[model samples]
Target: MTNKIDLDFLRVTHLRGPNIWTYRPVIEVVIDLGTLEEAPSDKIPGLYERLVAWLPGLVVHRCGVGEHGGFLERLREGTWAGHILEHVVLELQNLAGMKTGFGKTRGVGQHGIYKMAFRTRDEHVGRAALAAGRELLRAAIADLPFDLATHVEALRELVDEHCLGPSTAHIVEAATERRIPALRLTDGNLVQLGHGAAQRRIWTAETDRTSAIAESIASDKDLTKSMLAACGIPVPEGALVRSADEAWDEAQDIGLPVVLKPYDGNHGRGVSLNLVTEEDVRAAYELASRKGDSSSVIVERFITGDEHRILVVGKHVVAVARGESLWVVGDGVSDIIALVDSQINTDPRRGSGEDAPLNALAPQHGAEIILELQRQGLTAYSVPLAGQKVLIQPNGNVAHDVTDRIHPSVAHAAALAARVVGLDIAGVDLVCEDISRPLDEQRGAVIEVNASPGLLAHLKPAEGPPRPVGKAIIAHLFEDGEHGRIPLVGITGTLGTSLIARLVGCLVSLTGAQVGVASGQGLYLNQRQVAAGDCTGWDAGQRLLINRTLTTAVFESNARRILAEGLAYDKCQVGIVTDVEGAAGLAEFYIHDADGVASVVRTQVDVILPHGTAVLNAEIDAVAEMAALCDGQVIFYAADADHPRLLAQRAAGQRSVFVRDGAIVLGDGAHEQVLLALAALKPTTASWPTSVLAAVAAAWALDVEPTILAAGLRTFDAAATASKRA
Candidate 1:
């Protein structure tokens, strides 16, 4: 009992996309529980109590029992360390602000060793959380002290650095909901949705359709204002100024209570609002100059009202968020900094990171705040009299959702302003006394048009319901009937999978589409080899997916690849299983028996798109069994038309491909058409029944004409023979 419990990770693999476990990225860890395997939660005195005390959020995990407090019940009833670790790891990630719930634990046949997988948004954060969870769990088990808050804070910082920012993640999540696959192009916000030539990239709210010219236009405030005014859209009068003297002159010309800010600056940086004094305008000009690379600053008439941000996507206003000024009441006992902290930062929605809707108020972060305080004759150390209200920020905290209350005319004007600025997606900042009233009636005017606008306000608003701005942006990027996918084919089995994959690629290429293939021979682009030596892996498949010139892709999957790394692609339009020739040479992955081999091979069928088809070899009983697992249509293929599964498929008015009278016959129930004579096919392909039949079935599923498929088969046979001879 005095011995310290230890956990060791034997292996760690990051499944980048959909895998056998689930349809998302996951960190699969194989861990050696060592002596801890003998000890369950209930056996370790006070372990359950300690875990519940540390992570009370475990109550919401509707575990196997499927209700509130189900996991806690399991903890009390005695669960193994592997199961406990799964829940603990997930809970740690949740506490760290990267919420996730999917996890699984399975025994690896080796004594005291197990495999655990958990959903993860970022690989770095997931690994860090796993290490932290192991240490925290050990401490909890041994009744040792653990700094939970410090660990959680570090994890949150990691999330901020490694994971996608809120706006980009929101859009990615929306794309996922629409069943569009996505790949993070970099560690930052650059993300690709869909695959190959059909993919669209986005960095936050700016999509592939977002114009660089529009971004430049939005950056120039004076030009943007003029464009809106010229297009009959309400826009505030503004003038660019060079020096403090000119800023004061512009303020006077526009009348008192003018707003001063950098011409190209965004996110309310270096902005001074409702200024009536020359001294304030002069000081603000100095701050504005530092924010912009250019020396120019803009001074405009300050409209009297709450500030609002309207999100426009593809000529439509999708969301509106209103902003309010912040104030702190003097407690008389505390200084300005302490009073601001105790009053304003006390709100849970305010934090130092972008995850929080409202930013924590700190004097050091902004000179504008200090200047505002000085205008009221108070510094960070100054203590105000009791009951005195001091203004902190005059604007820029747009966190109130007002989408439902937006006046039609106001929404129209916002969309028009975005169009005038030439942005496909934009954030329009306008001032209005009442958003429910028309702009002309309320003297409302668009003050700023911003490209790559922050979407946090609408996504996680401080007040009112959250808006579906992510969905709007996704709709704008991909119009109706576009899933952002190119044609993809997958082949799996022990016999002739690589050859079948190449043949399918050849048939797809005959249609004039650029085809990319990854198989045992090599990675090929339209018959040109790009990489050599066993290219049937995740890395080779990823290259094809990311290639912008590839219109079609074919991948070869084997049992070893499935057990070790999972499939390379997310899902496939056509999945072909030539035959289950039996599991051999896979003992290294702990897949020893026939059942295990069948399970591993079924991963291919599991990924078939519902609208697509699965071409199964009816001759192999194990492969024939996979037809039931496909989410889409099934096309049975065998050498004999009398094969039971093939006969059943044809009887059920389904498609089947077989050989009859020395010819390949494609049959749909009562109708049968002879595609090509077996003798006419090249000697190499005709000799392999699994390869030729599977290729023909897959090509038929891809809608390649029979004549073209015949030509592709002949061409592939000649090339494959040449490769072997060479």
Candidate 2:
């Protein structure tokens, strides 16, 4: 029998090539879910027809439905099949057209095809796409095996008897959102008040879970300062003050030469310094009051020093910008107003539709200038006796020239400040004359601290974009084995779904760690769950969503789409954890050479792949079943002996592997295009369990040594310990 078939990705490889099927036909669908207003015509009956008709393969046999049956089994495995994936399938109709209220709801709509589509696209988009796609697919696939028929009937009978759904939340979610058949009861003729899960998934950790991360953030001034103090860093003497009255009292105690600011403020706002005269103090109070209603002001002894912002991540201080806010630097020709304009204009974050630097405060005034020059006993116009090393407070805010001076002590203090806060990432704001000087002797103080500091600052910030900083961070975040990050592969989509749960389960199990789940962005981002798209969204949060920007933003529900595309970039020397099709998983690392072409490195992918994958796909089932037969990480059964798939394609690869791992190369000259004598086993049980994985990831993050780590991983009995606790 001659039958046409398309390639469903068995093992990951480069884009389009020959298929495994001898005569099996291909199935394809095209669609646009971005637009949806009308419902469908027919339901399940029509859906089956549309799907089979469009499929390129001949109808071999019809797989009928049943609970825990082979059809569902095949469908689950189908996700790994690599065919061109689509977000929606307008070409097909929903199976048994989903049943609904007296009015029929379109059965399953586009999601039926989407289940497999994510897998297809994950494979097609290559590694980067797959990494993201795999995460998205995990989230999307949770909709299956809809409300059970028997359960729906039981629910309906209960509704009729009680005239009210079950008291618990689950019944409400089933009755309303699932639109499970409900008998309309006359509650003195009141409306039906049933509900469904507020959302299908809640991937966020609890309030306490998030609070820990915030503590390390600059959002809490007490924590920030405490951390710096722990590091034995020097700063102007300061204390957190609660009420305006406390601030006033403290400011008085601080006397005239003091700075009052919000304890947890950043970006140079809510700050007032150099109240040399009473007018400046009053204006400063007004600014502080305007900053916020819950404005907890900071009272500190202001030192006669220069200010600097030192960027640090882990043990490294990425960049140091000599302290300069818009106010201090001057153009000898331009007036203070013009000089302010020039400075603000150059600041991309500040100038473009942002609060101007000096609407309420001035960078340089007659008294300030005279004071700066007077300290040298001169005036602004006083020719500084041929570069008399004049010290300008705001004057130090020039374009950073770290090549000149960054005292080792200041760098040490900045790193200490970040460490004190118990954060792996931070930016230390400093006020110092010359970094080379001793902390006590230097006329400087740590002005502020930043958490999740902007990557832009470390790049070629206008003046440069913190590109190098980003590179360093990206490297550390995705570095392989110990001495690096615990590869964090974010899997989101219509997130909050089963895949997230499964992937989380899989990752924690493999790494032998606790599910170290943390929420991204803020409470707002967490509450909404899935980040939806713009324009006519059902909810208001959609309207204000950061949405997808070219910079560090998750696309509007399109993270799935991007993950689908990024599949190929998964190639790495260490380890990777992308889907059979390539997409996002590993963090993105960029390498730019003379061509200025930035090649994003996706690595440490092994962390994402689950243990039981062998039980799924037909091909992998066999290979994973015969684990001893497979040798090395990249055991491809390619078309030729000379080149494995990736090598034959001549693709450029990168290094990745978030935590500790064994490095292996595929398609080398000595071992190209060959099946291994002993296959690697696909895991049935975790080498390490969840808590162990977490411990390992944490240990890797802290750069624990291999011998120590292996001993720890070996000694850690996550399964037994967890079971015992349970």
Candidate 3:
């Protein structure tokens, strides 16, 4: 019997934000390769070849060698199981269509134990991938039969079920490219795109500005057509009908070859096109009624042209996708189902998931396909003669890009249709013989105006180039030179950081802005203590960020929270570090010395925006040294006016906060302003001068007026603040 190597998973942690690893979410797994510790990949017989056979995509991983096939080179030259596991998990996720590459493996100073981390878009999918990767690797090492295809399929299903759909991710990625921060608000596509009061919300293609009334009008097809026709935009004549008799009557009145569809249907569901017979019309009416929210159906004059979906954002049309009929040629050996599977579904663009540009047609499941086959006296099980072309679907395959070919008048008509329906973002379905010609010239007509339309067709069209629909949507939500960020301050240190956060929040609130403070004292919205406990962690900080009413936010963090969970916010307008102090209880995190503590705390400085400022205590050399690491300007604060770092910074025309002649002073090299007399604030701030100075410097960086700062300082109740912390 072969002795199987034992690889045990010690722990798996999902860091949901920027952490010590990188500036994105990653899954950290601690693995103990007990007996296999002595057996590297080269030592394990047949392991390297088996892994390569299973996951050939691992060749792209650069690993430590930093080039293509570097991981394979490592496998040949000998490497640890943990390192192999990292590459395997990443490859599995890539094959499952998530496309993540960042990963690392580090030793924890223990024999046979290592921590491996890899980037993942969703935590649930990451955990599942890790488990599958572990099992696959173990099977390969043991020379056990493992079905790689089954595992990959399972991972793909998990990804489809949990991760953000492709359309939502595209929009979020575009927002990130614009330096706008995004927070997923649900397991679904709902996302918030900025911080606090400056934020905007989006759910797939729809934005917060998408009016409820507009969406209602867009859903009702008859109403939408009426509104468009009234606005002088060309629309197909349509009338709502209640039953099969009424549907046929309306179709006859509109003339033969009319289209029958649900009155409030979406995604082409329950829609049958170009029916010239009474039997086909009645059957389509039944199908439409079953698919719609109500029993109502619409019969419209079938416009003689290929179907097109025009995407409109704000005041302009951004993208256009033209549809084509789907057909399959039989070889005389297979039925319609087999032909579709072999010919059409075999296209790489077709899939059952949202990632696919076009949806795979399942004859057994699709009612429309069944009905279409019945129209041609063909069933899914019927076999056609050799060289016979059978129509599987007419229209609804709107994945071919025609944006550049669209005439300006047609674009304007689509945009006007969206405006008539009151949609900020709309998908206008128009049928025209040629997109390059004007709609009036070709007798093209707008058939439907849709809200929250699927964007994947434009993002990854089967033909032509993919459009920047996601960028267009984001641009529509946020104006030029706006990233949707509110004024934010983050404070990190051991010495009275909570007091510093509270003071900053109070001073900012005096500027007539609603403030949210997350600190050790508790979670505060303005002056109200909503939750009383240790609120200095990532969860606490997120509460402040997601609050729509909050105009300004202050967060208090420490070395332990920074090491365990990342800072709550992505970037701050002002970052304050009062002191590095020490890593007393952080031995568990492997942070032993002051240097380790300094590295952890400096994360606060690392996240300052380019136009922001960092407030550092000049007394602590470790804290003051972090000034150079900031992307923005730095403000030094100390009780002593003669502090060298403060003095040098002031000399260079930079800002500094210090005490002079019994008063707190805000100074540049060329000018100085006395903020307040220390005697007036002695009752509240004298006990913790360092914290007070840090807060004042942070407020100054936030552009708070000196008089309001003094008022906030004098009115602060040190006793009440201390009690809250307790």
Candidate 4:
């Protein structure tokens, strides 16, 4: 939580073996907190840790850049070094501050980001830091000393005076100036400002194509009824009853066995079922009437039949589950005390953190049980007869409590319900005895839907066995097209909105693949339309799209479009959306409705972006992280001299090429060179452009054979030209 930033977080050493280390020039960082000065050789705390862990096989600087007298000094000499330094600086800026949410937010800062990173640097790091950082930033926003407008002015002043570094301070200035709220990340990746941050929660191939999941559509039971009606889902005739009397009135018309529950509640809360009489109806209605402030209550006919939760995220159906009728097994030998204790410990209430097993439906008690036991010729203290199964009616105080042993059909229903709710990740609740039966059975009903489903109950397993529901959630939400088969060569850009259609076309032509241009327009294009387009919109218009997708040369237009989608979906797999991060007059449409509904919406037109000036004010490292999102082998082309920074960062990860001539040449040296290689692509394998000569020379020193290197240089001349012609 400290405001002062650490500067010596540098000194990356490339690791090749157990003990061997090699040095690549690295850009170092030194925060000169003049007042909090340190001795000349003060070893930074987390700096050495990063070097030891993250740079295991990659090249790193021997002498870290240091801080002197309140300023980071001694910028590195090589293009690679400067690029790496800039990356660290931008991270520090996020550490120092950057607005949370999508890139469109106003400020830079997140909460408690540093704490988790300090805890783990490996797999647990990114998601942990992102979760905490955003939370911290979301909270800090309301308590800012001055307005966002005022903060921006101050940040600008700080940058103009060089008080803050160019890449990081500029972020503070940008976020503040824009009024989107910002936070500078500190150690552990803490969001230094704001609260309730919502960013980086999505990064996947399935769903989330347009960022539509984050936005919530609001409505009451009436809205639910309407949506169901439109989707043509079978629904029992019902009305929104605001009061117990109205509920009873509505229930009367619908006959016996009614159900009452909240209109906007998630999970299985505030609901009552199997009420057959006027008295039963009154109790259920009263309970539902005490709804949460953010929700509403509804009374309706409780259909007698089997139910299923069908979940569809984007385009894929994730899971389905059948609700089981609630029942408690009797050990016959154990006292009620042991039974209740054992059950409550199963799948406990929400946020209670304590596992509540028997407590799920309704915790058993001595008082209520005495009556039932007496009827069975036994008292609470008396041992139950062997092999006896007790069915307890949920009087106002109790309801179906156990969902841990649900039927497979119920699981299927849960997935279906998630799909029905239009969320990539969701949980559905069904109340039924025989899950495998058809949904029209007279003993089951679908209760509610949850957008973010938790499977702790299924995980710990209250009863028979444990299910990997959590893993299923991960798969449903994260898994993309079959990884090994897709062969997606991701292309990125800083100004991709300006070149999306062309980029796709270029890729298709180069790979001898096919395009899905019409898919973005809502058309389920066959192989026919993909080959028919002129490749116009796919060319320059997606500058905004590719950048946000991976930011090789992204533009603002693409950033805005993705942000506007709110969340991604699985359906985008075959869709060809473009110009994200850009604003169109209307919102970019996503496949949210069912297949029947979606078919009517898609027409496959080229995406258009709002025009704007290009902005390239981000730190190199930030851009590199964006590039890594491509998640595929990609070829980066750049003439602008700034794109190669992506290559340097990407080098640690995938098979990304620094394209110049027809043949690929490994790029080394400075950030500037990396940028140049990524940006320029007239697609000509021209006269041995010495532009890559310096990098080639560095490779020669690294022991690459001179003859092979020379041949590489020669190959680009003809290959690049041939690529251009193609």
Indicate the worst ten consecutive residues by lDDT in candidate 3: 717-726
Candidate 1 lowest-lDDT run of ten: 717-726
| Model 3 lDDT per residue over 1-726, tens place | 156657898878887766667778889888998988998999988998899888888888898899999999999999999999999999999999898999999887789989888999888889988998889988989899988899889889888988889999999999999999999888898999999988999999899999999999989998888888988998888799999999888888889899989999998999998898999999999999999999999999999989999999999999999999999997899999899999999999998878889999988679999999989989999998999999999986899999999999899899988988999999999999999999888889999999999899999999999999889988998999999899889888889988898889889999999999998988988867888889988888888889999999999888888767788988899999987776778876667788888988888898899999999999999999999999999999999999888879988999999999988999887599998888888475678887888999999898999999999999887667433323
Per-candidate clashes, comma-separated = 0, 103, 0, 188
- Local distance difference test, per candidate? 0.87, 0.35, 0.90, 0.34
Ranking by TM-score: 1, 3, 2, 4
- lDDT digits (tens) for residues 161-186 of candidate 4: 32323223322333333322222233
| lDDT pick, better of 1 and 2 | 1
Q: Kindly report which residue stretches of model 2 are placed more than 4 angstroms away from their true locations once superposed.
A: 1-217, 240-249, 325-404, 462-467, 481-726
Write the residue-wise lDDT of candidate 2 on 1-726 in tens digits: 012212222223321111111011112222222211122212112333333333322132123333333232333334221121221111111111111111001111333222122222111222333333233222233222223234334433333333321111222233333332121223321222211111111111011112356543567666666666666676667666765566556667767676766666666556666655444544455565556345567777787756666777677776776545433354345544444445453455443211221122233453343343444454545433322344434433333536236677678777777666655666677776667786778656776677645333333333532325433443333333222112222222222222222323333334333222222221112122332222111122122221221011111111222222332111111121112332233222111231111011111222123311111111222222232221223222211223323343234341111211221122333332211111121232133222122223223322334445444333333222122111
Candidate 1 lDDT over 1-726, as tens digits, reads 655686888888887756668867899888888888888888999899899899999999877878999889998999888888899999999998899999988897999888899998898999999999999889988999999999999999999999999989999999988989988889999999999999999999888888999999999888888889999988777799999999999899999998989998888888888888988899889989988878899999899899999999998998899999999888788888898899999999999788899888896456889889877888888888899999988875799999999999899999889988889999999999999999899888899999999899999999989989889988988888899999899988878887887888888889999999999888888877777789988889899999999999999988777767778888899998876555668776566777778877887898899999999888888888988899999999888888888778988999999999888988988799988888887787778866788888998998999889877776667345213312
* Best-fitting candidate, scored by lDDT: 3
Task: Please give the RMSD of candidate 2 to the true structure.
Answer: 22.7
Superior candidate under TM-score, 2 versus 3: 3
- How many clashing residue pairs are found in candidate 1? 0
